[model samples]
Target chain A: MTDVQTQPAISTAQPEDFFQLLKPRVMSLVVFTAATGLVVAPGSINPLVAAIAVLCIAVGAGAAGALNMALEGETDALMRRTRGRPVAAGRVKKNDAMAFGVILSLFSVMLLGMNANWLAAGLLAMTIVYYAGFYTLLLKRRTPQNIVIGGAAGAFPPVIGWAAATGQAPWQAWLLFAIIFLWTPPHSWALALYSAGDYAKAGIPMMPVAKGAKSTRLQILLYTLVFVPVAIAPAFVGLGGLIYLVVSVAGGLGFLGLALRLYRSRAGDEPDKAEAVGREAALYDVRAQAKPARDLFAFSILYLMALFSALLVEALSGLGA
Target chain B: MRLTPEELRARKRRNVWIAAALVAFIVLVFGTTVLRLQQNQASERALLEAATGTTAQ
Candidate 1:
């Protein structure tokens, strides 16, 4: 609505452009968390069935990514960070990407139903719809809390994995879901704090764009505080082991420490790696200042990885499950 | 059909995605089929064992 959606086509479409539309990086995270859910479940699954389940999850995630890119083509064209995406860059046609998404979505869900259980297929189907329909089309452009509510879409992977393994999703699976759901706010807020202008320009109402940085930072701290306790709960509830307890508590504290640092370090003009160009609309030299936002953003990745890895290790060792 | 260079390029791109998707589909479906057959065979073996008062040695 801000401007005309269509832009002049630039380059011809290429194979790599189609591949890029899948957002493989995000797909890998989905695959990992979903696989962990399968592995850590109580009963053993046949390896072949397990592989099929994981692959279906990966395909479903990639399908959703394609659909997201197809919808966001216009805004993606406007943002410098997303300007080079397949549809936005004019490398692939919108119809082709959309067809690719719809086909993959159906294929993955059907395969999961055939290979795994109908429960898993249903969960995967809902996840695809939640992400591509509710989050991308409805929530993203409309509200600042879009990521907060939409975070459930990403959180569903572990639950789907659990369902695939046991044909049921109990409360423990939801605990894992809660960890990722809570982690999303701080993780995305860090990116949003650094890229506030990009969101503003794209007409997306992200938290940092609607609320000031100070408010967003404080909220990030609040979420981390809540996340750390919930993250440590699995061990106390007998779902995880000592290793998970240590990892969760340590990683949670590290995250909290970083959040506190970000709150206090209100220095002027630092070259954040996240901005790449500048901080707060001003492009400055490389030797500008320290950037806590970028630091927290990087550490959040490690935090989740460590938390999940601990549970996986303990489960594999027969100490957690 | 005769086509422009841009049209040909677009077609090629779409083909690549389709080919990749086909490969993935085959792999996933093949695995599922094999696993389902394996499970069926295992259950049949267990039923045979139960009927014969013997187990696989």
Candidate 2:
């Protein structure tokens, strides 16, 4: 009798594994910010159309995320935080992920153009291209200011939402864009301060890895100073109400305080605590010296969420300025 | 080649999800068509009314 060799079964990727390529956590933020813009825009939109527009924006963002993961799979495999991603982990093939992303991107842009306006669809298309092609393929590994320029990709959703609602992107929408654009550097660099080792290992020149922790901290402080005024600008410009004003001012102050503390501390002066301790699970649990960066990173998320939530509530309650 | 039981199960699951996605897309396109037609009709009606008012004046 001839010995029989069993061949490995073809790709066993589950639906959940494909869903993981979408980067659901990041998609949630995109959905929230986009919805807020749609709600806060001056004109009324058909409710169903608005919902579809938000869905399109979210899916478009997710498609960009999938493309990013597909292209960065090798780099992601080198980082502890991203190693579990579908493409990086080999649960989903790179070609499959790329096909999925491209299909979703096309469908989302087409549906948005039909359901809303071509302008909104065009912005969504640009966002996907900017993130996946420009940011991921060109900027990410080439420069430390990657997040600064690439931040425009994340910032476009709110403007797209505004355009979807009013068929025009006004100054207020651009202000919303500016808020996210400024917020990205500080938020990203804070996380980078504690994860510099993973970034360096992945050959990505993140701010902390390229500029040193000291300079990154100072830059964060300077960005926070500039970002807070813009965060508070919505209130003054009649886009935000009293509730938004209070939230933005208070959260801005807290953001500034955390950035100042992070600036004074030696967070990224040494190797990442998790790397030093040889424990990938200890990502959030930084050493005493790195607590400031971790704290700033955590608080920055809360501050941004609070500012947006306040705007959302004010608009929903008919209390918007 | 004979397929393994696990491969068969995975293929079946994927087929079901693909069917669901296709159905959802069909419904979205149908609804969008209906909404767009209604919007266009409303705008046309308004334009006609405005023309009639101008003629009377």
Best by lDDT: 2
Clashing pairs in 1: none
Which lDDT values do the candidates have, in the order given? 0.83, 0.92
- Which segments of candidate 2 are over 4 A away from where they belong? A1-7, B54-57
Question: Model 1 misses residue A117 by how many Å?
Answer: 0.6
The residue-by-residue lDDT of candidate 2 on A1-321, one tens digit each, is: 233554435767888888899999999999999999999999789999999999999999999999999999999999888999999998889999999999999999999999999999999999999999999999999999999999999999889999999999999999999999999999999989888999998999999889899999999999999999999999999999999999999999999999999899999998765777656746467778888998888898888889889999999999989
Highest TM-score against the true fold, candidate: 2
User: Model 2, A140: alpha-carbon shift in Å?
Assistant: 0.2
Of the true interface contacts, the fraction found in model 1 is: 0.57
In candidate 1, chain A reaches a TM of 0.90
| TM per candidate, chain B | 0.76, 0.89
Candidate 2 lDDT, tens digit per residue, B1-57?
677888788778878888998898888888999999999988888888797875322
Note the DockQ of each predicted structure: 0.45, 0.63
